[model samples]
Target: MENVCLSEELIKSQVLCAPETKVVIHGEDCSVYKIENETGEGVITRYPVFPGIEILYNDIHMTNGVSHNEAPRPNVVEINHCRVGRFECEFSRGGSIYLGEGDLAVNVMTNITNQTWFPLSHYHGITIAVDIPVAESILKQLSEVMGKGLDFDLSAIRDRLCAKNSCFVMRATDSIQHIFSELYRVPQDLKDGYFKIKVIELFLFLNSPELVNKREERQYFSRKQIDKIKEIRQYLIDNVAQHITLNELSQQFNFPLTSMKLCFKEVYGSTINGYMQAYRVQMAAKFLRETTDCVTEIALKVGYQNSSKFAELFKQFMGQPPSEYRKSFVQ
Candidate 1:
């Protein structure tokens, strides 16, 4: 049987065909897929860079998770780079892993599960999917024509990074950041050509033995643990006006203190204190813009008793005092 390209397979999947999804084709080679759920919506734009190789930009802002039902194909490899926010991937084999800002993950399609979502309710990332056999042949032909040794093997890279059917994650490095940053900033007119060059450059970078050898070993949390951690997150968000200690959370949620700290950070990409601090400021900003509440009232609403301290933290996070922030939103 002829190989079906990864992009084609994804387009044929029910997830993309569901009532909540809207697909808009820009041209023969480019398309945008939008998804809406009760919580929020997500947009994915895809460009076919080369035969059997495609690039997708995923911009998701939804609290509710999306279920995937695409059958796994071992011949396909997916490369994901998390530009911002957190991606919670649940594997069919068991357990879940997270991709935070600047992180890179490479895995076979077979390892993906039916459930995948963004932990922080938002994620912006890039995905490069390669149909190994077809891509390899195309790359080889291009190399011969260009007279440059683009002899990197996609399958070998997959094997090296994803041994044992496990996803390989690499923490953000300077080189990785540089490559992706350029991709993110490419001019609209230059996108097509720029993407082709960058995608080739990306594969070459991945082919490095030194890089793969030093890949980070990320921790995976069980479903039950992830549920409890999410519960703890919701409880904290629901009661942002109150101060809660880690010890109290551990006892209240029946989760160990050490694991709670570690897993929470892993899943949400921030410590509990850090996450709450940011959340409070975000809520305060919302109130400042949407409500007539005074600074002190707004501060108290977000659990700050001292208006001065609230102003200080607000400036620290938002680059200006709350009063100024609110005024800027005014006429």
Candidate 2:
């Protein structure tokens, strides 16, 4: 509902994006998308990349389905098939969603899904699908549902995804799909606040598949994969407070330093420093968001060597200074 409309200038900027933004900035590739969600047909150009989100209307005859983005390749949803919503889709470790040909119109989120097994770093597309709906009645309901705030169990999403152990993923998806279908099935006037959020939930769940820890029970991992990841997890936990070095793994595991780096990098899907930083921040966030400890003290306790350094890192990691972060979560 917030300025969901795109301006001509914004479109121009996107269509004329630079090539090196993703590289020099360590950012993801962006694409320009202009598909209308209309009942009539049309052909949409697939300019692969993004500097900004581009959605335009093409009323000419082509393929009606080319209007909504189920995604041609993890790209933004662009199409004109009575589009009811928009959602940004992004994957860091290479994520994809296949919406069959010439725009996608789904009563359900995924008909037959093919998800990659990679560490999809958070590539958040704006829930444009939510924005496209012309019904406030439906949007209202969706806002309430999604706005109930995330059901976060303080988990940073499972670093790995498992498809065949339990049915959390499938159940969650189906549960949401049913909600969306029920809403869309209703007359538009009666659909009030129904489809978009649930649809967003369906996609978000798929995007952020869960990770199972050593202690928690869940439905992913072959024993072999678990063992390997667990080794890395344990190594991290054991050395939580120590300054990790590239060569340290060689000393501890007897692998050559390069092998250790390669293996750890491969397993964790990021540099060793990035993983440690995330873990440290996760741990630090708990204190900032839960306890009353002073920032300096908390930082030191979390293995940061200096308070100044900790404060800077805390802000970088949490989007706010430690004091502000602490205050926000203070009861």
Candidate 3:
């Protein structure tokens, strides 16, 4: 595994303009690092609102298999929001969390080197990392304002948030989406103040009574199980035009059918069929944009023998008919 702290070095090596990828401090507590490569660009901007509280934004274009990244930090609490694409994170322990759009994952660190991979060619998101002690103080102050007592121990909360191997996934509710969307729309001039405010707002939302019970922990899988599931996923993608059955996958991977289904869902946040359908549609869309192939031929290439059915599915997934979708870009 690569050192998480200096994964930036990995990027530097691939970046066309290495010197442009550098860090710049905005104020006493905020820093921003800009990264650019041949395929795309990225910026990691961070605001240290408190002694140990940080709010960061990651806007990047990521191509598949470009690279994987890991960061090793101890006792770090991170809240990740996937605004655009999916994030597949492999924890040091044994499991992985697949965070999709409007999904949230809270990760508590313990000197673990967690690796993050982008499933698509692009990713854009924001993350807030808080230190336990720092959050304790903030929680205390917020409690006093509400005239409420601190019934739960901060450490306990920390442990629970990261319970079951250090990561939990939650759905981003409407309120949560609104908060982050507003943050994204903030004017450049007001970004500094907005960043601090949003970080506090996020904590408040997390602590709200409505959200506590709604929090759903991500399911955990052993390293071996997860690896096999990943293999299955890749195999499906590689042979997108073909139909593969659960029994076949299970027998091939030596995994129980039920376990394979559950584990695949846990890692990809979708059933195997659902994931395959999505992948096929994505591949079809790529063909529409990059190739001059007609809709019927492209449909067959992606495993769809019926052109009309292919167009219907493509419209459902891509929001327009194949011809229009292609014309929008090509014309």
Candidate 4:
């Protein structure tokens, strides 16, 4: 594993770079990469668990998007867990899949398209990338010492999960969630050793026969449909002060109401009403913090005519009424 430097190899493979990316090496085994554009910025902190394997924490906040012209890497497999927010993965074969909160995806680096973006303009996730040959050699030695029954075949795992160069995505079950939840809270002192254990556990979990056979399929939306959905989202945000129905949106966007509803939920991880309600509450909160507007005025500005109804919804989403919430923000 020591022979293969995962960070250096990933940069060389062009799998982790964009024209906007700036790299910062923290140490021999750790690095940080930042991607910035007109919309926002993203920071990726990477740590090598072994020579051939690495873990990256991706925190991206961007409105526009980031473009990457990554070359094919048949020997690399990436496992992604979406802790929060939404991730859109477009494949070279023309369809795109979304990974919402608590979703996991495994795909060969060769299958990714040149474009990837966050549907919500913010995303937090973890990615574990393995260099097949190097990982295989190291895991073999570890397996021999651990037990003869241990299964750690990187090629077989990749083939099973990412068949025909397609990504495998599924909702994270209890077991998978347990594994990843611990990863997010690892103690600093035991970070390196803990990551090694977790990576091995993740591989073993993926290699399980039950997981391979019983995994559910996720929907893939066309690029055209995704673009339309994004446009619909932007329109809603721009017109947040107005009341727009699904039918109205359908006519305005020239998209079918049924398909728009489904695809919009899939891409943004919420139904239109649900998403907007939350968005409205979020805007109200921002106004409360940044502006001196009274509760009723702020509520009306966010499209709620009735202050009482707005207060109810705001408390439901923010766990407090507007007046109280605004007070907490006071210095």
TM-score of 4: 0.94
Clashes of 1: 0
What's the lDDT for candidate 2?
0.38
Q: TM-score of every model?
A: 0.93, 0.35, 0.74, 0.94
Model 3 segments more than 4 A misplaced:
1-30, 34-42, 60-75, 132-165, 208-212
The best candidate by TM-score is 4
Give one digit per residue, the lDDT tens place, for model 2 in 1-331.
Answer: 1332322223322211112212111112223333233333222222111122223222223121211222222112222122222211122222322121122322112221222121221111111221122223343454577785444311122113322211121211343344334433445443223333444454354334332222223222233442354465568767777776657655765556655555455444456778788778778889877777777777776788888887888789789988887778766
Q: How accurate is candidate 4 locally (lDDT)?
A: 0.83
Candidate 3 lDDT by residue in tens digits, 4-112: 2223332232211133556665444455676655556667776555555666777767532233234544455677888987677665565666777888877666524
Tens-digit lDDT string for candidate 4 (1-331): 4343456666443333465578875666678888788778888888888768888888889855556667788998888898988888676667877788888888888886556788788988898888888788888888889887565678988888888888888886888798899999998899999999999888888888677665667566788988999889989899898999999999988998888999999888899999999999999999999999999999888899999999999999999999999999899
Candidate 1 residues 29-87, lDDT tens each?
Answer: 68888888888888888887877788888888986667766677788887889899988
Who is ahead in lDDT, 3 or 4?
4
Worst 10 residues of 4 by lDDT: 11-20
Give the Cα-based TM-score of candidate 1 against the true structure: 0.93
Model 3 lDDT at residue 45: 71
Go through the candidates in order and give the clash count of each.
0, 38, 3, 1
